[model samples]
Target chain A: MEWLLEANTAGHKFALMAIAILLFAVVMGGILFAVDRPKRVPTWVVVAGFLGPTLLLLVVGLVYPALSTIRGSFYDKTGDEFIGLDNYARIFTDDGFQRVLLNTALWVVLVPLVTTALGLVYAYLVDRTRFESLAKALVFLPMAISMVGAGVIWRFVYEFRPDQPGVNQIGLLNQLLVLVGIEPQQFLLTAPANTLYLIVVMIWIQAGFAMTVLSAAIKAIPDDVVEAARLDGVGGFQMFRYVTVPSIRPALVVVLTTIAIVTLKVFDVVRTMTGGNFGTSVVANEFYTQAFRQFNFGLGAALAVLLFVLVVPIIAYNVRQLRLSEEIR
Target chain B: MTTTTPVMAPVPGEADTRGRVHSRAERAQKRLTSRTASVAAIVIAVLWTVPTFGLLLTSFRPELDIRRSGWWSMFTDPQFTVDNYNQVLYGGGTDFATLFVNSLVITLPSVVIPITLALLAAYAFAWIPFKGRSVLFVAVFALQIVPLQVTLIPLLSLYVDSGLAGSFWTVWLSHSMFALPLAIFLLHNFMREIPPSLVEAARMDGAGHVKIFFQVLLPLLTPAIAAFGVFQFLWVWNDLLVSLTFASSPDTVPLTVRLADMVGSRGSDWYLLAAGAFVAMVVPLIVFVALQRFFVRGLLAGSVKG
Candidate 1:
């Protein structure tokens, strides 16, 4: 508040504001450029329409900031120095950043696998059930809530003050633990377990997605094949394994890879719950930490780039899976 | 453990013995699914629902009670209260109604700008023979995966630089950019499905491109419009990141961000938080339910490739 008020008085913010508008206008203009077809709008007019807005926006809003972030990553914390590879080196060697990386690894791997598996099973079970709509809707309700909303809801579910006298636990898990004649621990503050707690949020949000995609796939499992399986006396579990799973394999890949890609970008829950404290840091959290909290723009940009890099493979796989499915059709 | 025996059973015509085993295995499978499968489905449905149920209950409980006890405790004690509802709806100075008015002010324009731009861009991509259309569509689609958070800092910086960070135009523009890719992809698939002959007929009738799109195409795209509108509404409404980063001015922030502050200040105020969360969720839920009927049949209308 103080700085903003002072900055306003000095009129520095105005210049920055103009630059922002110009950036958007240029980007929109660039989009117009690409959009221009010579016959309809006249090539020059089309080019001006597209390039004028898109380039302005991209340069000032997106491209410049991205480049600035990359540049900042090469510089020191205050965005002044020029140190190459040092920030990247710190990410690999530093204990705090390493833990963040590991937590992210566990999250990216486990959440997607579990959520997808859960969705697959749910999809199969509810495929043609009497209550399929109701069941799927229940699972997907969380999807409509922001990640932040889910995080706040789960925070209470995992909330803990120390198990001291008169604290009275609010976290449901801890409350249950106390009932079983065991000690209640600060679940969010606990080392490795906290990561599990955070991962559950992703699973909750994504399982519905998995279920929706996989259920649709399950429904699309050519009725004839299912009938053939029935004639072969492959009922129940066998039918699912041989007939259904194989049929939905492409959709399964899409769901799994989508979840993996989303997992790479997990942020809100960590930020909301523990604020990236304890040992539950992930790449997104680390990116924020380095960039915003610690003001280490260089390391932060490195983390963001690493996230982008790590995500490309899964994204490619997902796109590949989609293209393959399109081709098969 | 049981898999190897059945799969490795003798060829079907080998012996009656093998036949009996096969029939037994088949019967076993039937029994396994009918009896046991129901149990697994129920368990998963129940497990998946717990946290949401917790949120539902927390919304109804009194503020003090929420801070004092686990949300699950409502089952045992079953204390019915509207205190939270009261506090959330009409209690404080900046009540839910006021914040919701703010949310609406922000949400309406945000939804309109993207849909308008996306529809034009999507039409151009789908029909108006353009250069690099596929690449452009692909690029747009790819941007959908960029973490909104990653965009936030730069977006905020850009907004700050332009002096529009706190304005409705700033948030609306930000939302439009973020939403363009998905909207274009979905709408393009739909527009392509419109049968090129219809477009060609309009073109032959001396209809301009914009006229054909709005007068001819738009009406036919009701289901698509409704579907995308519902999604966009839900997305913008539920969105916290952008609403927080770009639209946090006193006049502009939406319910999701306001809900966060309520949680921060009134951490112990369950009544406020629950009511607020519920309020934020209500419109999206309504949108889904109303449009949900059109949802499945809308885009996934045709037999899409599995």
Candidate 2:
């Protein structure tokens, strides 16, 4: 039993994993077995058997914790004193947190807008081109890898060394700079531009998602609509601007809002690339830093609540757009 | 690739009109922007591809050469070795091998547990006639908007109080809980697409709900299951935050956490970092490439569902 809880060794971990699975199977199986005898069990009994565990887990895991964190936000740093709204006041007043909020704004605004635009253009370019899948796959490959993996890849590309007679630049970006007679710069260490550099990594990873969705939306455009637009002398970019963009407006909103939500919660990139240093800390990363590293419980809970607050409007807009599109359909 | 609206093939006589319209538009596109479009596409592809290629090439280079010159030097210099991979995998004190195993242990159950639970819940939401079914379904769907950040601190405290803080169980349970809403929503959408008549026919034959779920629906839900499975697999495997919060210890750390740690401590060691990054990347990359169809389907279904 103790080893099941504390799986320190490789063998113990695997054994413990087996037990966990087995335990889950038995519990689920027991419920099903008891309820499968139809005509004996009530409908609520079967419903409970099917949905009870999930509802219980959700209430315990998501709802309870979220409400508790919101409550914790009004407390003092130690989480023992009930200091009302002080944590929220400090978050709004502090200079470091102001930069965190501003940086988050930049990320939420930039990554989605640029990534969606790039994806739209790319999807349009290769819509019916030769080697379409292969071309799309090249950009889409980054979406497959971890953000940490992406951070490492881009870190090497941005790697800098002193530009002296004996030193050769290893990072490709710096090497390019040196070839044009510019000195090497530490891309990650600089403050404002560093945030942009980190955002580029996100755009690189997410362009595939936007491209994929938008490409499908482009293809789903009724051929007659395109033909009608063409008959109206809407050739070249006009066809795209009028026919393509309007047709995929719902998809465009979905991609933008989805990417915005993802970017808002982007902890991995900032954590991996800069570890939220040099003015790169966003709300998610700062939440982790305050809670885990500094052990500032109430402040961390406030940052976490701040993140939840920011996500509400975006999700509301998304749902409204979804409803509108569904109504039109 | 699955277009929701079917494309109607042009009738034989109308093909000429449609074809001419397309060709004229295409020719206009060609004459106006062929060169620029080609250049832009090529530039985007090159920019997207070269960084990963450079890192992959660097991973195969010797340590001294990697430190001395750019990976582009390989075209002129042409030196390569697997020693970096060797050192990263089996290197004393790095122990990426154990981290890799931890990733597998963490990911497999995280994928399986949530999926099974979501399948059952989705079935009930889609098929079972119950009081408050629509309200319950809508509640689960709405829960998808609860960002995992809000839940982490208290969830951590809850796990610590339960004495499961640093264990695999904590990671598994947290991931399972976090994944349920989206999983239930997606799987429910898929399940509802199945004709209710199938379940009705089974019910007419005196089959129970359990029998109908197992015999009629589970087979049909394979693609949906696979779709969410691939999504969850890549998610759990590539995850850093959840594992970093729950299982940061060496005994339970996955590849991403360990790799992120290496970047912080060994930021300058390109050889080890490059190879270690690939070690973290290889599984999800393979899964993505192989299951890309399901992944694309899942992504499209998850987002654009009008």
Residue B105 miss distance in model 2 (angstroms): 0.2
What lDDT score belongs to each candidate, Candidate 1 first?
Answer: 0.69, 0.91
Docking quality tier of candidate 1? incorrect
The C-alpha stretches of model 1 lying farther than 4 A from their native spots are A1-61, A161-170, A323-329, B1-29, B67-78, B89-94, B261-268, B294-306
lDDT of 2 by residue, A1-329 (tens): 57777776778878888888888999999988889988999999999999999999999999999999999998877789999988888888999999999999999999999999999999888777665777788999999999999999999999999878999999999999999988899999999899999999999999999999999999888888987876676767878888899999999999999999999999999999999999999999999999989999999999999999999999999989989988998
lDDT of 2 by residue, B195-292 (tens): 98999999999999999999999999998999999999999999999999999977899999989999999999999999999999999999988888
Judged by lDDT, which candidate is best? 2
- Using all chains and alpha carbons, the TM-scores for the candidates as numbered come to 0.84, 0.96
- Residue A73 local lDDT, model 1: 64
Candidate 1 per-residue C-alpha lDDT over B1-306 given as tens digits, one digit per residue, 9 for 90 to 100 = 110001222233432444435557655666677667779888888877887677788888766777677777788988878777777777755477766766766676667656666676667777666666577667666665555545555666667886766766677677767776677678777888898999899889877555676678889888787778777887788777667667777656678887766655665555666677778778777777666655544324322331
Error of 1 at A190 (Å): 0.6
Candidate 2: pairs in clash: none
